[model samples]
Target: MSDPTTDPAFLRDPYPAYAALRSRCPVQQVPTGSGGHSSYLVTGFEEARDALADPRLSKNTAAFFAGKESGRRIHPAVAHTMLATDPPQHTRLRRLVTGSFTTRAVDELRPFIARTTDALLDRWPAGGPVDLVAELAVPLPVIVICELLGVPEPDRAEVRRWSGELFASGAPAVIDAASHSLADYMTGLIADKRSRPGNALLDRLIAARDGDDRLSEEELVSLGVLLLVAGHETTTNFLGNAVLSLLLHPAELQRLRQHPDEIPSALDELLRYDSPVSSATFRFTTEAVTLGGTHIPAGKPVLVAIGAANRDPARWPAPDTLDLDRSPAGHLSFGHGIHRCVGAPLAKAEADIALRKLLTRFPDLRLAVSTEHLVWRRTRLVRGLTALPVLASRT
Candidate 1:
C-alpha cells in the first residue's frame, strides 16, 4: 500500500509484509508514480522463480524506461552490460565470460583462496578485536578479482570505492553521477588493457574480442566493470553475513567446526537462510502478463524478493528456521534458470575458505560489541554488516 522503502514495519523485517502481500495477492501491482504507477513485486516462492524464468519479462531496462515517463535514463554503459541484456544477446554476452566461472576454473583457485584466507588471518593481531569484514572478506575478493581481471594494483582501491557508490540505492542523482564516473573509469581501463595486454582475464576478453568479434568494445568494457563488481561485492557480503549468522547461532557454528566437511552444506544453509542478495535484479514486463491470479500491465518494473522466496513456507518446511542438513540446492540465492549467477562456484569457494579459516584460526572468537550495535549496510538489497568486530582468542 505504501512505499516499502520508507515503511518502518518493512524496515524492521520485511518478510512479514512480503508474506502478507504474497498470501493476499501474489502478483499485486504496487504504484511507482510517474505518469502512471505499478510494478509487480513478486514475493512468493513459485511465482518469483517462474517470473525469473519467464520470457515475457525483460531485463533490458532501457527499452522499458524509454516508453515510460519515469525520468530515469539507463546509462549507456550500464545498458551494454549483460545484466540488462535480454536473450540472444544475454546468451551471447554471458558466453564470452563464462570460462572464468566454470567449475573447473573455480576449483583451480581453491588453493589460492585458502592461502589468501590464511594470510589475512595470519596478519591479524594475536589477541585483539578486528573488523573481519575489512581485514579479510572485503580485501580477499577485491584482490582475487583484481588479479583475475588485470586491474592494476594501484587502481584497485579507487575502483572499489567507485563501484560501491554506483550500486548503492537511493538519491537518484547520486546513482546517476556514480554510474557516469564508473563508466569513464571502465572505458579507460579497457583502453589500457588494449595497449598493454597482461596475462589476466581482461587480456583474455580483449583477445577474444580481437579474434572473433564475439564481444563489442563497449560490451567488453561494461562486462569488465560487471565482473569486478559482481565478483567482489556479493562475496564480501556473503562472508560477513555468514560469520554474523553463525556467531548468532553458536551451536551451529560449533557443529560446523566439529565436522569441517559439513562447512559446504552449512554454507548452503547460510545462503538459503540469509542470502547476500535479498532481491533478484529488477525486471520489467514487456507485455501484460497474468501471474499468480493478478495481471501486471506492459512496461512496469518488478522487484523479485529472493530472500522472501527462499523462506516461503510452501516451498520449504520450517522455512524460517535454519537447518544445516536441509538441502538448499533449489534456493534462489544464486537466482533461478537462465539468469542464475554464473560466478556462483567462485563465490562459494571464496566463502567456504573464508568462513572455515576464520572459525578454525580463532576457535574462541566472539563478538566485540552487543548485537544491537551491529550496523547493517544502508541498502536493503545486499544485507550485511558494516563492521563485524571479533575478539581473537589465542586458544
Candidate 2:
C-alpha cells in the first residue's frame, strides 16, 4: 500500500481508512511515512487503550531507536522529557510540573484566556472572511503558552515557525531541524530565566522539587521544549477541529447556541468526534504482547490510533454522527494512563472559553468556504485544517 501519511485523500479523512483496517487487521504493520521501517497501527478501541497503558510498550525513543539507520537522530533535549521516559524517570519528571495544571492554577488563568479570546475576536474583520487557523486558533494558545512559560513575546513568531514545520509527515531532516530549533530556544530561555527570574510556570518548574530531587538542567530544558510544542498544537487543533465540527453539524451548533452551558460538556463530544491527535506518539514493544487476540513481537514500533478508537462503533453509538450528548468519558483523545497529556486541563479550559465566546460573540458565524474546499494538513500526527475561513456576523 502507498504511504497513507502522504496521501491527500487519506489526510482529509482517515476515519474510513481506519475503519477498513480495523475490520480486517486492527493490529497490522503499515508503511510508515518515512518510506522506511515497518509500524503497527492499532485501531481497535480496547486494543488501543490497553496498548497505551501497557508497561511492556516502552516510550523511550532514544533507547528503541539507538543504533538504527533511521537517518535521524533524536535530539538529547527532545529525548529526556517525560513523554519519552519510562517509570522512575517519567514519574520524577511528571511530579516536578503537575502543579501548574491543577484546577486552581487553570482557574487563575480564566481571565487571561477570556481576554485573549475576546481580543482575537475583536480583530475579526466584522463580517469579512478570516482564516481562523491563522487569526485565532493558531495564535491564542501560542500566546497563552508563551506567557505561561515566560517566553518573550517577541520570539513567539520564531517559535511558531519551528512548530509549524515540525508536524509535517515523515520528513526526518525537517523533524530533526525542528527538534534542534526548539531545544536550543528552550535552552536559551532557561538560561535567561535563571539569570533573571520571574513568577511564571517556567520559574516554578525550575524550582519544583520531588522530595529533594529536581529536574536536572537537561530535564528542565527538555520539559520546556515538550510543553512549548505540546501546548501550541493540541489546543489549536482542538479549537479548529471543534469549530469545524460544529459548523458541519448545524443542529448541534444550534443546540449549543440555545444552551451555551452545554459547550463545556460538548467539548468532550467534539474531541471524540474529530480527535485533534490522530495517533499517540510511537511506542515500541519491549516484549511479545497479545492485544485484540493478535500477538505483537518485541522490538516492534507500535502506534495507537486515538482517532480510530474514539469513533469505534462498539464503544460509541452512531459512531460517525455528531451527537453532543453522547458520553465521551473514556475517549483516548488525550491518551490514557501515566503518559496522558499533562496539558489536557489547560487545553480543556482554553477550549471551554474559546468556543463559548466565539459562538456568543458571533452568533451567525459560518464557514466562508465550502466544506469540500477545505484543505487538511498533510501531517499524520495531527488531524486539523490548514485554513478555516470564517465569516463573523457583526450586526
Scored by TM-score, the top model is 2
- Please give, for residues 85-105, the per-residue lDDT of candidate 2 as tens digits: 998899988877788888898
Worst 10 residues of 2 by lDDT: 206-215
| Model 1 per-residue lDDT tens digits across residues 122-168 | 88988778998889988899988888888888988887887677656
Q: Which stretches of candidate 2 lie over 4 Å from their true place?
A: 33-36, 208-213
Clashing pairs in 1: none
For candidate 2, list the clashing residue pairs, or say none. Answer: none
Off by over 4 Å in 1: 1-12, 33-36, 67-74
What TM-score does model 2 achieve against the real structure? 0.96
lDDT of each: 0.81, 0.87
